[model samples]
Target: MTKPHRHASHPKLVARLKRAEGHLRSVVEMIEAERPCLEVATQLQAVESAIRNAKQALIHDHLDHCLDADSSEHDRAELKAITRFL
Candidate 1:
């Protein structure tokens, strides 16, 4: 099989995801420490937003840079699949 195509934005996407991961860890810590519900919820919301943004950015990057005239039926199907997250 061919290697997966790498996009110019992959590094930025990875960094975005890492930041989300850090936020998630903080959320877990807050929950463990029995922080106020509102505070925990706010942090959780931030984590969710970070993850969602990263996903959307990655999807957009893929759609912009991965597809081409030579793309196959499977690539089209994959694009449709990824959009379900949004």
Candidate 2:
């Protein structure tokens, strides 16, 4: 089996995701509290942005460290596929 590849940025990405999780919880609390729609939407947007940035960072780290001169076409294809999220 292939060994797992770890990136230096993983901790930061996890931290970002955790913050997004907290933001999501706040969004739910806001909804339950009957907050204004605009306020909720703004907070929700921040959560979305955080998650998106984390994902993009992870994908970039993968491309940078996991793929190399010996990487296969399939791997390159997968790289293209993953970027669709960004």
Candidate 3:
């Protein structure tokens, strides 16, 4: 199988991760400040959703670019690896 390389969507994926990181930091601060449990939970949920969306975007880009460059046999193996994330 070919090694994975960065694709056009990589920058967007990085941005999403950075946003999630920032949100996570905020959640930590909220906790430190003794914020309400519900408020902290809401922010945590946003972080989780951001991470999930980033993962989906990465998988979509990988399938689009990597699969197109590889053989059918390799594609099947790559697809199996990808499905494990889903």
Candidate 4:
């Protein structure tokens, strides 16, 4: 049997991850520069928040565009599994 295709990666998600990469680099710089503990912690938190937001955006796109576009019982079960993992 052929494998199922879930949400394929797209440009917008790639761009978001690139931006997150920059944010992660900044976090490393903050550590190397010996910035104050609080400031470094804040940037770390920002990295977490950025990742979470990006994940949500990708999921939103997948739900709105892919899952919503396909509505068979098999698709519904696949969606349920994906949602559980998400």
Candidate 5:
């Protein structure tokens, strides 16, 4: 049987996605407004940080659920590989 994919339970994941969406919209606005390169770069960095936070939240959930539920040696190795990214 195939295992179910687990998702992060934190509200922060939703907030991160919303923030990214807003950031993208802001980027578009910046381009339209002819904003400075430095200002745009700052906004891009904020979006990158938000995405990283989302990734960490997902990794936390995976470690708690999928990693904990698996019993096989290969699963252990895969879990280690994934957790190493965190």
Candidate 6:
């Protein structure tokens, strides 16, 4: 197998993941503070969406760079592994 190349968008994807982590921490803080259920739920939803978006971006980058570097057989196996996250 060829060495997997890093995607150009890797930094952006990492930034997004960091932002999602911060958002998750905020949600934990909100729960500890005993904030209203509605407010807490809303923040949780935002965190979830951010994480999902980050996952999608990472998957896109993987498909774009990693898959391009692989043979058809390897790509099929890699794609199966990647789709498991979805």
Per-residue lDDT over 1-86 for candidate 4, one digit per residue giving the tens place of the 0 to 100 score: 02554455567778878888899999899899999999989988988887887787776666776665547788677677667635
Q: Residue 61 in candidate 6 has what lDDT?
A: 72
Global lDDT of each candidate = 0.85, 0.86, 0.86, 0.76, 0.79, 0.83
lDDT string for model 1 (1-86, tens) is: 04667788989889989998998998899999999999999999998898888888888887788778788998888877878988
Q: Cα miss at 54, model 2 (Å)?
A: 0.6
Each candidate: RMSD to true structure?
Answer: 1.8, 2.0, 1.9, 3.5, 2.9, 2.3
**Cα lDDT of model 5 by residue, 5-83, tens digit:** 5364767678778879898899889978999989998988888888888888887776777755546888888777887
For residue 86, what is the lDDT in candidate 3? 59
- Say which prediction, candidate 1 or candidate 3, comes out ahead on lDDT: 3
Candidate 2 runs further than 4 Å off: 1-3
List candidate 1 stretches off by more than 4 Å. Answer: none
Error of 4 at 76 (Å): 1.9
Alpha-carbon shift of residue 30 in model 1 (angstroms): 1.0
Cα shift from native, residue 17, model 2 (Å): 0.3
Candidate 5 wrong stretches, greater than 4 Å = 6-12
Write candidate 3's Cα lDDT for 1-86 as tens digits.
47647788788789889999999999999999999999999999999999998998888777776665446876888788996885
Writing each residue's lDDT as its tens digit, candidate 6 over 25-62 gives 99999999999999999999998999888898888777
Q: Which ten residues in a row have the lowest lDDT in candidate 2?
A: 1-10
